[model samples]
Target: MNLDDDPPPTDAAAALRLIEDQQSATARRLNPDARLLYWPWGVAWLVGFGLFFLRFTPGERALVDLPNWLPLTVLFVLLAVAGAIQAVASKRAYGQVSGDSARRGRWYGYAWALGSVGVYAGLGRISEHLPHDLAALLWSATAVGFTGALEMAGGAIWLDRDLFRLGVWISVINLIGAIAGPGWHALVVAVAGGGGILVVGALARRRQRQRQQP
Candidate 1:
């Protein structure tokens, strides 16, 4: 009955507990209900892009009576605010999964998404003060930068690389097109740059769903 001679049994028990914890974590990852929550947002993007893109003109400035860029700026700031809220809520919801180490901090994208909102908001203000085209150029850069950060986690999960690369490309093209200002070049940017992000976003979303499947 000497406990000092029972080291092997103690080690085996500890190993069993570790295995159980891993299994529990894996089960949570594959939850189907969580996967289902991702689809409606994708659908909304498809609709928004399809309706507005073909006819979108720069400086349309969706905000009502807030000056040209003011409206757009407001929209972005609101988005940033919304993102900040979501980021906080998600930490409460998903707990540690909201941090990195889980698919490179996919939840952190929520924060980055909000950050894009700020960039556009700044651009909106600048556009109001400066020459129309210059304001647009700045806005475009801000928009792309925010978009890239949001996509970083998404790309890691979906593309297996940094999503920021796509962001850089998008920001660069948007910057050029903003400077180019109007006509076919702008059209090309709208269709290509925006569309590319939408497409890749859709695919990344899909990968997220599949990962959660049973």
Candidate 2:
């Protein structure tokens, strides 16, 4: 229980191992699991937008008989849940780590908050002027586009290839869906955008496990 009572590392190898152990602990504390960062959004997109596709298929008649407000409600609820999860994960990972990285993270978080407000403000005004289907497409495209842009920015900040690639993929699908129009957009994003993120999250977790192994 006394600091002076314990023996130190007996050899160079022991000392190196001690250092490695400390570095690993610090890394873990500094980097939250990628699954936590990604999977929540993946599920949100997958289920939320999947429902959107069913409910708002391009034709006036919906493929599935869902309440008019159900898809939007579910999507917003899931997005809020994802945001909460990411916020908690970020706080736990970076709460103690200070420096430029912490500053950048805080700024990035601010960007997300402010960018969302701006997007909603602009969309709210313009969406009212558009037809229902076009309005829906505009909302989905812009939301996805905003997310992809932020993902790319985060990747650039962290120098994370996986994150950047995921962002690129999201952005591409968003564009394609926008071009394709409403029903198809939701289907594409729900399948490709959401599914791709899930795959990336799984791969990231696998890499983390491999790195942690002896």
Query: Which candidate number would show the highest lDDT if scored against the true structure?
Result: 2
Q: Please list the C-alpha lDDT of all candidates, in the order they appear.
A: 0.50, 0.90
User: Model 1 — which ten-residue stretch has the worst lDDT?
Assistant: 33-42
* Each model's total of backbone clashes: 0, 0
The TM-score, computed over Cα atoms with residue i paired to residue i, of candidate 1 is: 0.46
Residue by residue across 59-98, what tens digits does model 1's lDDT show? 5542223334443444355445544554554455556553
lDDT of 2 by residue, 69-148 (tens): 99989988998999899889989888877999989988988998999999999999999999988898889899999989
TM-score of each model, paired residue for residue: 0.46, 0.92
Question: What's model 2's overall lDDT?
Answer: 0.90
Give every collision pair in model 1. Answer: none
The C-alpha RMSD of each candidate to the native structure, in angstroms, is: 7.9, 2.6
